[model samples]
Target: MAGMMRRSLDAFCITFWITVFLAAISSATPIEPRSNAIQELWSSVRTLVFPPTNRCKVYPGDPEWPSDDVWMKLNKATDNRLLVKPQPQASVCYSGPFYNAEKCAEITPVWGSSYTHIHDPIEMMSPVAQGMTCLPPNVFDSHNCSRGGFPMYVINATEPKHVQLGVDFARKTGVRLVVKNTGHDFLGKSGGKDSLSIWTHHFKQIDYIEKFEDKKLGYSGPAFKAGVGVQAFEIYKAAHEKGRTVVGGEGETVGIFGGYIQGGGHSPLTSLYGTGADQVLSFDVVTADGKFVTANSTSHPDLFWAMRGGGGSTFGVATSVTVKAHPEMTTTASRFSFTSKDIGNETFWAGVRTYVDYFIPNADAGTYAYFLLLPNVATGIFTFSMSPFFAPNKTLEQTQTLLQPWFTRLNDLGITFDPNITQFDSYYEAWRSSFPLEVVEKINATTGSRMFPRANFETEAKREELYQNLRKSSENNRVQVHFNIKAVDPANADNAVNPAWRPNILFAQQAVRWPVNATAAQILKIRQDFQTGDMQRWRDISPGAGSYLAEADRLEPNFGQAFWGTKYARLLRLKTKWDPQDVFFATTSVGSERWKVESVDGLPNENGKLCRVR
Candidate 1:
């Protein structure tokens, strides 16, 4: 009787809860489709199963399309800063009622301006927008380029809350998320079709700390916090005013906190200090879970390590970054140029090898040369142009003394060249005059890079092989070589930059371009020339060395090993932990191997869905 009484109590408890649940469900507005058995069963437990919020995202032409209610809610989330992508330039070119030559001519100078402009709607820096079928139209074509490869909507994010809102929206609703700041992405990562973009260009917050404290790293120093929209020139100006400088990019308009530093930023000061990623102290970011937090040595340390050099738009959206700063210093600037017409190809390359041989000594003496090695100027002429070199904390006399050997060697080889050297009062002035606005031009080229170690210049045979391979590749094309020997010890800092950069003296790159009217077959050949054909030449030289993913081939084999070296595994693990659902995706980035972009009509484009591979 006692056991029966206990069983009756248990049954009574269950029945009581069921009656209460049913009463609650009946009182509340019922979910439709109660006629279905499964729906009825789920309705009873809907309160516990689903949250009281809408997580549905509608595609174009869907039954529940983007209705007015949807737009109203999205606009409220971002405080009415949401925007629909437009094509004002397309209207100026071929979409107007009648073509306006005056407007078209007016926009030519500004064509390249949109590449770095934070507010530009264009997806590509190049005039010929790749991966688009209608873009780069012919002069006689009737139609203009539409928003084929650009984002469907953009949130002009100005604060951490804005980023969090966008992240939450994209996460709750299964939509692709991309970040755009200045639109300076080399791999076209700033744009994606049928996606929602977080335009962080308005998140411009800069702060300086004279005595920084980090209990995790156990060090403190002078540092600056630059927002996501902070460009190179802006940071330089601010640092100069503070009587200090920071390691950054050469492009004046490139965002300092975006893919530049995330991809192991190299600079003229690399030999003296280190790469930009090395100087980072912390980052304030919004993760895939829609939480804004700080990542540093002590807080979210794994995210900090991965974010330093693991490439951007893969883990989360960065709101701002704090990096170390250095005191201002004077520098000796030199500009030199010579032609192969003065010396034939065989002798010219021999002279080139001799010049390259001095990279170690120059780097040791605190000199970094920003030069270009062009094998062909026209029909049979090659050019070696070191437009402006930096000799930090050196006087005019010391600068000339350092360059005297190079001059003497050129004189001995009968190579007539102009050596234009000067001294600057500050590094800012030197960088300003040396690396100008890059002379904006309409270019449609993809590039592949290789980091050549200092050992390549040690032996005559190695140098000969390097020069021979470069000459053969540039026989009918152009390959530009940048010689900046990074002699700093990366072991001092823990980050994810390519290991190959630690022992490299030069960064060599080869690129190919195609016309707007080029056939699909021709475009494929151009891409293959860089990814497979030209890359093999450099691979033969540095079999173990890796390339910079910021300017590397998209078709690179074993890209994880090439980009991250031994850190690939750790990075992949952290990527999974941080973004298990793949909220962020950039081509060739970590964990991107799991997804493959859709191909359209035998051509690859972002319009199609990014389907999972495995």
Candidate 2:
């Protein structure tokens, strides 16, 4: 029986690689036809001799897994920058040889902040994606420590050559590959079980260009070339220092060039300028074939389009990206809060409806509002908190005038809430003071989000329906709403961003968390109820709308349509052409549907081996 099973696996591997080789050849550029064909043929034969068990990627304990000597060669090839046998960040908190009570105590206090995880080579911000293997001692009882879903080894990449070497090693050895930059990914795309990781957090070089000329794209403007590891605040401050600004994210720690821009980043500046992806000019990447290339409008246009908004870690590993920078301008910002304690549920929800009603006008005025709705039935408390509302290039009186209608409605409803508005001379000053430091590291919660299109608010009836659906969804989950809308330029509309986003007015995200010690069945129930039950309310009202890929549900159904919409088919084709060997794997990334991560005990995690399912 064992011999027969082995024969079957061998046959399947050969056939699979043969198909892959043919597909790759058809898409291979004429310049590298001979070399590409030879490489594909060699890879296919290698797979036939050492077939992956269950058609999965190579994992530890497998005969095909690299030997110590082989890893040493990789380490030397990359100037001894390879981190062998990397461990999880919280491993020291567990009862193990690596445990140190003092160090664990220090880590525990800052575990919730993204700053702590961003510095670690292998740590991810979300513990749920980390497979909940090891957490701070205070969060749970000290248990066995394991690497869990993190990569087995990491190349502390500081340059494009290091990324190329890592990509080549993973491809040749058939080991799963993942890229990590700042470890701010919400979908756990940065980590994978038994994978080789390229840690790009050290690529912190940023160069400012006073005049960036791209004749092919018919543009010449001020721009910045930022390394993949450059964070939001860093670029914002740098651009401000040069008397310019660029589209960026709300979270100060979010990487500007990696997943943030690649996932169609939305921001306070989105209303005035555009999405973060729209500001991109070009990307320098290491392709799957281990070649370093620059992808721009004139060179590798398809790859450039896919990388702009197709989602990251799919086509290639980007070393740096150049983005357009706009002139810095004055801004108006505000913060206010009201709760059910101040009013009744009906009036509170009514106030929320008034706020939703103004999303279109506010977006038209080039304003962005980030707010939260927290409803706790058990405590009989509901809160609406707008940490800050940003109105770029607008004065204090102008912003107040734009929001007067909503305030009038609130006054009519007898809702008294202070609109603590303030004006700043520069966008950086307002941004630094307005947006609060985001609290991360939610181990027990799973998140789902949707982008609500403008058509949903075309009529009063439709608007009411949207409000009621949101109110119902908020009853069981906290809802975060960002009023960001923009119409894509015809010249830049060919990218892979969801069509729903162009006509969208709101991006809302909701999270559902389970108890720390919940049973497997209980956790499964929470996830199912949230995705299919609570989130479905938002989905039903906004038919044909899409969700934000960066902050979307992990188990979103029909994710191809939900994340990329009409652009999914083209994105898939581009993914196939560039990464024919499927060298890169991230959860729900482009082409990820072809692979499956087997879970343990109903939890959604990357702890298991990744197998080719299609």
Candidate 3:
């Protein structure tokens, strides 16, 4: 079985790249030469970088579609594992092409949940990716699923060689390339138009190294090597069974070592330890040049630093990551909330403002809280912010004592509340109880966020201004605002993560959800408003502060300053050195500003091409 699997995987990659190479050669276009030394020199560079080919891509409806012989050869190469499944847009939508309205209606109710979407390897839970270009904006509109915003083909990559093949094929053939692990990206980075995607969902492997040591970094500890397909829950479970714990996301389905850690992941453990990127020991990756290399503090050190927090799909395809593991500890868990009976009530705002003010102190006390503020228009009251927090190495009584001040402030303001606090003997237990509640179904929403430093919570005047602006913007736009309170100090472990994370006590996020029937202009306006209006308060309150790129505003102005801060310039230079021909491009990545997705009538069309700005 092992030999068969190996041969099948090998054949799949070999056949796929061979077909791409043949396609490129068949599609070559004749160019008129300028007949000058300078032009010829430049032409040589261009040809070396982007080899011209006529048969590179077999687009739908193209005359050069693969013949039966070609299909049989490719199938034999892959041991009949190559997949040609089109986008399943219609499977869950009433407007989808294959299903009747009645049957589609039946599927919609069950499929509308976030769990259902995340379970599928390809479907993006949010309608944004689904409706970006092809599917009708209206979820209920009857239409056939179109491959407008999705990849034209996908290779089910189960090994590093498959990834290398996809990367080399894309570079050599001049076709767009994307990597998908769990398809849980917030910005739809996993999808691209007329692109070839390498799906690493099948690459599930976990190995633990006892007394793992890196001689160059002068460190030694226990570490777990997680494959690209591994999720947070899997690692947490495996680590726990081995008498250890790992730093990971709150979501159960989130890919741990994939894009999460690459974007400088934060967690309840961040306050006590450091950012997720700080736990990295080594990474096994396939570079753009089709070489599989192990990057660590000693080898390919620059690539190691960049991949830690620089953002995904910009450098190369990561196959596995070995991260630090900490000893397991007990935790105190609590969930708190207070709802106002009257909307815009002065007393409610004052009390909530006081709670917000305590964010810094809470983190300093080794508590991590995931909180959200919601205004209840129907009840004419605020559905006060909710916080599910966990304190490590703290008893139930100590945890309650730490939280008593905030409760007193709420009581002083005559606020009502029902708080659920509990104690767990282990970190894993505390996580399983509350983290599941964090799951969200995909919606038509766009987020804008900021990292609020200690200064924002230090002064009373600043606190008042921050809360007032937050309330105004959130209430005015009917947006939901959230905060992740974590006091992170990386202990001088240098990497490409935004410098703003080091001093920040609160990570603030605001999201605007649009109506399904809204016009393109309205949607665009909402997107624009998120940057200028909705996020204005965050920008004003935290000037020079950056955001977490994994979930920040997509249309962020001066994005380099907002996402990477002073690190952007260095990241750009490294990007050129690693991928000089720009083999990979994801929206809002390190060097994405140089390209634009094709748009028509002031809105992006799914069928339009992604062209270089120059």
Per-residue CA lDDT of model 1 for 1-614, tens digit only, reads 99999999979876665565455445532323323432333342323211112232234554434444454466665667787754535345665564567766666455456443455644555322225533323332326655555777888888787787677666544566778887665566776666688888777788989989886665678899999889888899999999999998777888888878887888888888778888899999988776778999989999999998999998889999999989888888888777777577777776776687677778777677888877653577778778677887787889999889978887888877767778888888888888746422234466677888877877878877877777776774756757566747544778888888888887787766667567667776777766667778788788888888876656667889888889999999999999977878877899989876664433334554555674
Model 1: lDDT of residue 35: 37
The predicted structure with the larger lDDT, 2 or 3, is: 2
TM-score of decoy 2: 0.92
Per-residue error (Å), model 1, residue 240:
0.3
| Model 2 collision count | 0
For every candidate structure, what is the RMSD over all alpha carbons to the true structure, in angstroms?
Answer: 8.6, 4.4, 10.1
Superposed by TM-score, candidate 1 places the C-alpha of residue 303 at a distance from the truth, in angstroms, of 0.6
Would you list the rank order by lDDT, best first?
2, 1, 3
Which residue pairs collide, candidate 2? none
Candidate 2 lDDT over 440-478, as tens digits, reads: 657778788888888888788888998888787677655
For each predicted model, how many residue pairs clash, with residues at least 3 apart or on different chains? 0, 0, 13
Return the TM-score for each candidate structure: 0.86, 0.92, 0.86
Ten-residue stretch with the least lDDT total in model 1: 48-57
